[model samples]
Target chain A: MNNEKKKITMMFILIATLLFGLVPFILLTKRSGELQTGNMLGILVVIIIALLAAVIGVKRIKDLKQGQPVEDELSKKVLNVAGARSFYMSLYWLLAIMLLQPVIADILFDSEMLDAEQALGGGITGMAIIWFLNWLYYQKKGVN
Target chain B: MKNKIKELRARYNLTQEDLAKKTGVRRETIVFLEKGKYNPSLKLAHDVAKVLKTSIEELFLFD
Candidate 1:
């Protein structure tokens, strides 16, 4: 497929591989007390595999960045569309969360829930995650 | 908003990177200008025009 598709597929594959790699640990161990010695090697292997995959993904991105320019008219329009969608919708999502924060906190935690300070911290964290995700998606899919 | 970047670069045979180095803009900024994705600040436009050996009006088409 196209570069966008390839990037998304690679990301999905990486996530799936990571979750699958954790399955054995989840199944075999009930607690830290029950941890087995032999599983250490398995965990190490998973870490290495994850690192290798990350390296491959980063290399792919670097190649794209350094590759010949492709900002033809169509791509530029696509980028603008993508950007408009991402920014507007993502901000809308964030607004919804902020508006619903009290209800969510009351349900998810005791009503002693996050106050302004904690909420602000959590908001910043959420913003960072969303920004990173947006950046990744734009890099993958022409920002549209 | 105005620049003579492409023409100047063509005249000097300087790559975008070379111009970026001389003008202290990121390569991406240079690329952005070349592609017309952005209308840069007056300062940036002037700087680029000055480097490119052309007036801002020559480099940019302001509506």
Candidate 2:
């Protein structure tokens, strides 16, 4: 795509990789008591792999600058509509979870959950379901 | 809202893809418009009307 689009793509890839990959890795590591030598080695390997991925992503973006336009108006509108619907869906999901947290905990997990950790799993699952519902809505609305 | 996009397309011997390209929209959008499942913005309606060699008023019927 164009330079701006390529830059945007690269930025998106970098942020996504950090958010979905590195953040989880760090969080999982933090769950353990103390870092063993093996854990240190694993962290180092992850860092090296992340760096290599960043380098390749940057190179790919640079190469993409000479390609076609990133998105036309209609495609952007489709995304806007789908994203807005998903936003509403997620908002409702959060509200429902907040309202029914105790009931959900009792019914599903059989626990008297009163903390964020207990609700976190359900919240994530709700978000995933919202995303799927948004996809289905888009499909029904004939958004390509 | 209802539109005469399919009728006009057939009259002009233009496929939905051809009309979509001419109007700078996806075929899905055209399909939705023709089926009355989606309403177009004023600009898109004008663009499609222009590509179909018709006026917006003649192309779309609003209730």
Report interface Cα RMSD per prediction: 9.1, 4.6
Error of 2 at A13 (Å): 2.9
**Displacement of the residue A108 alpha carbon in candidate 1, Å:** 9.8
Please state the error at residue B38 of candidate 2 in Å: 1.9
Per-prediction DockQ: 0.05, 0.20
Give the TM-score (vs. native) of candidate 1. Answer: 0.43
Model 1 spans with C-alpha error above 4 angstroms: A1-91, A94-124, A134-144, B1-4
lDDT of each: 0.61, 0.67
lDDT (tens digit, per residue) of candidate 1 on B13-50: 98997776676655666776877765666787787888
lDDT of 2: 0.67
lDDT of 1 by residue, A1-144 (tens): 776547746875875778686876756674655554334434544565565456546645664566523333333544466556667766776787688887866775546455654455455445444544554555444321
Largest lDDT belongs to which candidate?
2
Candidate 2 residues A106-136, lDDT tens each? 7765676635644554555556556556655
- lDDT string for model 2 (B22-61, tens) is 8766666777889987778889889999999999999999
Error of 2 at B13 (Å): 1.8
